[model samples]
Target: MRVHEMTITNDFQPQYLQLIAHRASTYRSDIRIRFEKDNILLDAKSILGMMILPFRPGTVITVQTKGTDEEEAIEEMCQLLENKTS
Candidate 1:
């Protein structure tokens, strides 16, 4: 398994956070997510699960992935979170 740390720079507000979370959820189905004051933990491949996390800007998030495609999953997730496209 692989784990990565990320920060949410955009959509720091509550409503935007919700939107981001929802969008992320739509991308994956069963992600595990944990909320923290400065960060979150996302279990790999759990898009839906990660979407429910209540996060704000500057929040730190840890993404963890397991399985044969763990690296790919982590990279994809990082891009999704960091990418400004939309």
Candidate 2:
């Protein structure tokens, strides 16, 4: 298992969220995103779950993964949240 702190930067738009879920699903890891303040944990690969998270830009969230590709999963998720283009 691995965890990293990431700040939300994107606008959480529908298209971007679909992109996020697609990225998350490419990994073999069990990934989750959490809003520590509210104890809200969401499955990273679920578009519905990601959409329902109540967060905004600059909100610090925890990205967690447990599996063979945990490291890459976390890094990619962080980049997505940071709105970084690869």
Candidate 3:
């Protein structure tokens, strides 16, 4: 398992959805996205899951991955989340 923390500069924008889908498709079920805040654990890959999150600039997001390619997956996810675009 791998974990990293970063601040989100945008909410669930269209580009974000596309980026997430593209990234998620590259890996097997071993990879997953979770939006953690306090006791909340939401699926980051799901469009609806991301839409429902109370996202805003400066929101801290913790991405976690657990699998053989977790290291690469984590790096990709970090880039996607750090895009900070609309």
Candidate 4:
């Protein structure tokens, strides 16, 4: 497994972050995501699980991936977090 810390940018506010998280969850199931502030952890690939997180702007998040394509998953997730486009 691999873990990384990422900061939420202005472009990825609460709504956008939620969308990204939801998307990430859909793309990969062997990943775990945690909200930085509250340390709430959930399966990133589950839409319902991602929605449980109350993410906001400036919120920090920890992403962990474990699987055959863990690195790719992490990279794609990071890109989604940083990219302006959905």
Candidate 5:
């Protein structure tokens, strides 16, 4: 398993959530995002879950991924969460 923590810097819209879900679904690893303050943990591949994901700037999120491609999944997820790429 891989764990990463970072603050979200982007204001994501519904379309971006959909894109995130799509990207998550392409990976074999089990990806989950956790909001510590809210005590919420959601699967990245679930559209419904992604829809409610916290995207407010400065919100800290912890990403957990497990499985064969966890390394790559964590890297990509971090990039997306940090808004390092489009």
Candidate 6:
């Protein structure tokens, strides 16, 4: 398993959430996003699960991935959360 904590730099709008869910679904890894302070953990590949996230700039989150592509999955998820991609 791999895990990384990062602060959200972009707004968690519906489009962004959709992008996240789409990206996550392409990977074979089991991906999860956790808001530690809020005690919320959700399947990153589920649009419905992602919709409940209280994400905003500066909202810290932990991303965890387990499976063959965990490293790549974590990297992509971090890039998305950190706004390193369009």
TM-score, every prediction: 0.58, 0.87, 0.74, 0.73, 0.91, 0.90
Q: What TM-score would candidate 2 get against the native? A: 0.87
> What is the Cα-based lDDT of residue 28 in candidate 6?
99
Q: Write the per-residue lDDT of candidate 3 for residues 1-86, one digit (tens) a residue.
A: 88887777876676667668566658653445544554456555566665566667777778877777778888888788787567
Expressed as tens digits, the lDDT of each residue in 39-86 for candidate 2 is 888999998887777657777799999999999999898888886432
Q: Which has the better lDDT: candidate 2, or candidate 3?
A: 2
Considering TM-score, where higher is better, how would the candidates rank from best to worst? Answer: 5, 6, 2, 3, 4, 1
lDDT of 6 at 12: 70
Q: lDDT of candidate 3? A: 0.69
- The superposed Cα distance between candidate 6 and the true structure at residue 44, in angstroms, equals 0.3
Q: What is the lDDT of residue 39 in candidate 1?
A: 52
| Tens-digit lDDT track of model 4 for 31-78 | 787787887887776666655565445788888888877888888877
Global lDDT of model 5: 0.87
Top of the candidates by TM-score: 5
Off by over 4 Å in 1: 12-48
Per-residue lDDT of candidate 5, residues 43-68 (tens digit): 99999889876777788889999999
- Model 6 bad stretches (over 4 Å): 84-86
3 or 5, which is superior by lDDT? 5
Global Cα lDDT for candidate 6: 0.88
Q: Candidate 2 or 3, higher TM-score?
A: 2
Question: In order, what lDDT does every prediction score?
Answer: 0.55, 0.85, 0.69, 0.71, 0.87, 0.88
Tell me which residue pairs clash in candidate 5.
Answer: none
Error of 3 at 36 (Å): 4.6
